[model samples]
Target chain A: MGETPPRSANAGTGGIRVAPGHGQPAGASARVAEAPVSTRTPGGGDLGGGGGLPRARAFGAERAFRGLTLAAGTAVLVIIAAIAVFLIAKAVPALRANTANFWTYEGWSPNDTAPEFGIGTLAFGTVLSSALALLIAVPVALGIALYLSHYAPRRLGTALGFLIDLLAAVPSVVFGLWGRDIFVNPVRDFSVWLNTYFGWIPIFGGDGPFGKSIMLGSLVLAIMVLPIITSLSREVFLQTPTANEEAALALGATRWEMIRTAVLPYGRPGIIAAVMLGLGRALGETIALAMTLGITFGISFNLIENGGNTIAANIANAFGEANDTGRGALIASGLVLFTITLIVNITARAIIYRRREFTESAA
Target chain B: MAKRVDASNVTAYYGAFKAIENINLTVEPKTVTALIGPSGCGKSTFLRSINRMHEVLPGARVEGDLTIDGQNIYDRDVDVTAVRRMIGMVFQRPNPFPTMSIYENVVAGLRLNGVRKKSILDEAAENSLRSANLWDEVKGRLGKPGAGLSGGQQQRLCIARTIAVEPQVVLMDEPCSALDPISTLAIEDLMFQLKDKFTIIIVTHNMQQAARVSDRTAFFSIEKTGDPGRLIEYDNTQKIFSNPSHKKTEDYITGRFG
Candidate 1:
């Protein structure tokens, strides 16, 4: 990105000489040399030697600031590497000790003599619940973000944005308790209504009690993740350049049309990153899902049935009554969750980076 | 295709602040009129009010009357979008929708007007690019993003996008300010050709640009810092530069004070 400006400057100079029938190539070359001087001044030693004492002091401060920021950035990578190494070391022993097929086994009985357990149902439930939660949350979040960014009045938008930001600060345990107590009944009624109308569909075909089902757990997770997605998306939408928006409007676009053309296209990668962040949050939310979902061992797609379990919830629920093997098994499940989150984050970053050239050029 | 623009006692405000007051001007069809003023003198604001683009900002609005070809644009029953369709704008900084392809950017206005036929879009894109003098440069790379182009090319792409809809009037707010001298020259040359089809109103900080491109010129100035900007003089470009009626206009034209 830094190299582009100098290259373009050189190109501009070359184009000028060729097009204008000018014979002074030396002057053009000198102009090109001058273009990059300001960019190079910070690192140049001549400024400090020839200039006043204050110039040397400012250069020292700049070097110290750069060094401090570089150290802080490297520290983050070191900490992340340390965590990954620790999780893998704990997870390896448990996998080797397992008697049954760790990949396909349907149940967890790691405390048994031959200690058998697998992540099949737990991983499935984790992915399904989180994916469902994101499916429910993202569209609604985008709607609210657009409303706040474009349609709502300024004061109302700011107030609503602040309230949504406050929602993100609420503890997960509070959400869990609220979901368990207050939100469960309404979700169960909705699930029953869905089942009555759409029972032929496998996911809604279940007839048993529906209060502590995947539907309920996912609804709770969706609500928990909603604020993060909405806030991030709102920020992205608001950051759509005024010039671009005016360009759309001047081209005869209505307000919504302006947003469709200028704001949404600009915010696509950002909104994707925001949704992936929400998915990550939903995937690892232990207490909320544990409290809302029925902690069953079997895998089923019947969302209205009281039978679902996730990896994080399993760890939280099973950690209390576990022996050494059970504890190891729980850590192994955690490692899988970490891996899933890592993949989610990496994919999101890749999507954003793919459009970096366009976005950076605009800036 | 061009339509005359008439502004009568037009005043603009941003919240409680009066930006421009009691400005009156008439822009003839198929003619290029330049609004030349110092920075902060509200030339851009007055230019924006002609197409009702100023009101897009919160608490920014215009009063009195602005009309196109005898139809009052700011009437209570007027559709703002339709008004904008008849009048397009090119901003100071080139702003082609960064995510769109060059082809998409050229057809963006047409898409808004619901012209979805591929053949029609292809024809319009080629014509508009040719009009903006950018077709040969960008014809092979139409699928590439608009932001991938050089700054001058991006500005021309914006011009192509604006002209693709065939607006009757084109408003440019300091279009050449962000461009290099060569690119500025290219745009100035384009303006001369464009005036044969569209009424052009350009707000420029460069006196030479006004002298070079505009058929008529309006000079704007403020008496003091907090005072609203007023139109000091309006006349033929040659007359304004050589023999202005107002002392302020002469002072400004001679670079004595802005």
Candidate 2:
């Protein structure tokens, strides 16, 4: 009864750290970090009652170890926090002074010779492009995960899974280059034909000769983010309880039925989390959007006729070319992207928390 | 209560590792047959094979014939789904579905098998819980999640779920191992009542548990000579404990070897 499952490696070795068990009242499993050698009593496991040179040395080593580990972890956390704060500080003045022109005024010519700046188009473009990307990606990504986990043969699934992971790890800039070279040009040719056939439709009419529309930019974005969503979904689906899967199989349910009844319900929390994580990536994405999107400034809702600019792309496009006001405005745009990502992350965690309650109730 | 299971030359394997080999026995119906052994001794694997659960692991292969009533369970044309439905199992850990209500967990199999009417599901769910002796404890919270139950309650609920499927045989792999003494006794007592309607094959590490709940016992040993596991003796529970014919069985029961 006393031999509980050992605390995982991260919790440090055996001074009785708590295992994360179901419904363990918080603080009941509080770990007792080992006492310093000088603090140890004569009756303790280690006999250091005399407390001399060796014991002092041992205590010093313990403090040093903990200090170094904590320092490394804190450093990483601070770096991320610093980046977020810096983005916010630099963008605040511009954000506060952002006139209606900041979001609604379309003419964004940041030249050294003449004064000009506005983001009405960029704000709309960022949200619309990312949303369109998600529309193209989430369902297909979920399907690939389901097929690999439950339907495919073992070897094929394993091999294909590795390939997906490799693709996910590839650099975003690499994907941008590849997307432009392989997909954008060819799709530009095809988009013109599409616009010709469907040009009468408002959604597909009137812009560029070759048709480098928002749809093309979104499609390329979808391709770039596909592997991340698919891999995460696969991991979440795989984490569904082994018992639930077996219990379903024992009930005479078909493979598809079991996934519907058991796997999907269990994976819902993780799937939502995965989508939010992908959205964060999409929000921060710059180079890929810059390349695939034709860098147009007009706010056309039409998906197939005109390319548009996003907040991230506008920052990248303007920062290198402009003077003071343009840099401030670009910094402000970066701030907006950062705030959206933070809100998305916080909301995702909240949703996951609510899901945990639902899961516990259902179980 | 007594029940019988007829397995002839049954062998189960995971790739080159033969998990269980050539286990043949006739377990009388409505009786509890305990399979006792040490860890990795194939008792759990043997219990799983009866319900076709061994196939869950990748590269797992079962050979020879397993039959409950002269119908070879391993026959080439046998429907694996059907075999599993007919033979339900409870695992060592209490694993009630984490996303179903307490009532739903009990009726899960019935609902999934396309039995939709609320009346039918309600009847099945209530009846199974009653049979598992869990109805009173869980009746008040039928709408609550199965995961909300205590460890023992959850185990009983799993039994109730297995009961709902109306399997001809019930196979349990160390069902009480994760529980405390009170919980263990609760399940052991439930197993006794359950045997009146189903053939039960339980694999246990505790020798005293085998003596308490089982009517008959089959002692399975690890496959000797790097082969795999095979049943060393199949006999009445008393005889296996008091006067086993096989030397290995005698040693194991006497605590000389597990």
Candidate 3:
């Protein structure tokens, strides 16, 4: 505390981000790093440098914590990156041999010796069915969320919420099995009824899968993802500020009105995130659609008639028997699916981030 | 007097536990009535009963007649929504709807009641804002979300929202406790002006505040002898503070006991 130190020791020890000589620590910013780590008594003969042990222990503890976090986070990132890399390496030859037209031209011949593979049909089926699934899931999911958060009594809400979360945690294979045996069989009549009554719409207008079509696949996918979307949306709706809710009710608004003004407003970002989570689930849905969709590799716009295959469903159905180019092309499809999911997840996060900022500034 | 709220022999309970017993009060139109008491004296609880706001709590039941202008609010034929529509309320903390803009926050009641006319909404919103004395500060930022406003502004915004519905009576529960001195003064002024247009019933811990703002004050005390809470005094502001009819009231105002 008595002696003055040299400039370099002062600057470096001060923990300034820049190394410009003679520059001091920001007046209020006061670098606590420079403060001695010792709690030595004032007259304890220069404290015997006791600061070293605790400083080292604290540093070690902090470094260990940060190291563990960074390692865990990076491991996850690297694993995903590795998977993408593997998919790209496997698919590059197929993509190089074919052009963007590979995505547009409708032909599947990965099994043949000189077979040309095109994802045109698969891409169309995937996008169309996913879009349809979103259309079906968003409104129902939001409705369930609203009911769970605002309409239901406390005990009932807790029970129903638990059930929804349990449904979400059920294995995808089990959902597929359920779809094949129970849900699809029962709902087949409804699909046929739709085709009969309102088949004028191109989606429902088809030659009839006898209840096995792209529409059926979309529906199965939608049902499978319903709990996921609903659960996430419910949490977001529940997180709506209590004051915000009461404000609406005190204004003579109905329960539904309070939800519209407060619950939905606070939950917009979460709802978008919920839909994306459902979309991710839909993109990867394979066994359920395969069992129910009557999978065939053909391009058709009529959703009620012929079965359409998603990227995941196509891979599952054909990956075992596929040959060299066929395997490569299938892996290529996997790559495209991976890219699409990444785009969806990243976009969802970006939306949530922007929404947080928007609400923060507004608040 | 154009009485806005009349509660006769009104008693409320939660399950087997009686919360407030034998409350008789009349709130006149264009006048302020204060409910002052120590904690758990049913001051806030009684205030909420007037607007049926306390009914939102589960297992809360009322055992006496409550009316606005002689219309029984709890009658089987009465619509709860219509009853609440006539009596607006502000809470302990400023509770502006977080997601809505200030404009939307004020006009939410009108919108929900199917008032789709934007011009009418605009005019009402402006009038309410002016009545709450928040118009000049928040006028240009009606499109901005309400939660962004400061605590005092948010409280004022809530008052504005209450005014927008044009209710017959406005019930406030510790409306200025969360505010600063300046904010509290602003609200006191707002309340003074608001009494000209609507009946006001306020629950406050500040006896000085009660003395300043209220024309009539109901002094309440909790009796430890029974499990249920009892209302010890109900009188004019002057009598309650200057020459209270009850010992508990004297003890409370003279700083002898809570």
**Per-candidate total of colliding backbone pairs:** 0, 19, 1
- Candidate 3 residue A47 C-alpha distance from true site, Å: 7.9
lDDT of 1 by residue, B58-142 (tens): 8999999998999999999999999999999999999999989999999999999999999999999999999999999999999
The positional error of residue B206 in candidate 2, measured at the CA in angstroms, is: 3.4
Model 2 CAPRI rating: acceptable
Give the top-scoring candidate (DockQ).
Answer: 1
Residues B1-258, model 2: lDDT tens digits: 223568888888888888887888888788899998767778887788887878878889889888877788888898888888888889888888887789878888887777899999999988999998899998888988888788899999999998798988898989999999999999999998899899998989899999999999988787454668878888899999999999989988898985
DockQ of 1: 0.50
Candidate 3 residue runs with Cα over 4 Å from true position: A1-59, A350-354, A361-363, B1-3
| Per-residue accuracy of model 1 over A1-363 as CA lDDT, tens digit each | 358789999999998556423422343345346775433234343332564321222333447878999999999999999988887787788888999988889899998889999899999999999999999999999999999999999899999999999999999999889988998889888888988999999989977888899988998899889999999999999999998999999999999999999999999988998998899899989998999899998889999989899999999999999988788898988988888899989988988898887776666
How many backbone overlaps does candidate 2 show? 19
Worst 10 residues of 1 chain B by lDDT: B143-152
Cα lDDT tens digits for candidate 2, A74-98: 9999999998787777656554554
Best by lDDT: 1
Q: Which regions of candidate 1 fall more than 4 Å away from where they truly are?
A: A1-86
* lDDT tens digits by residue: candidate 3, B187-243: 988888888888999999988889999989998878763455667777889988999
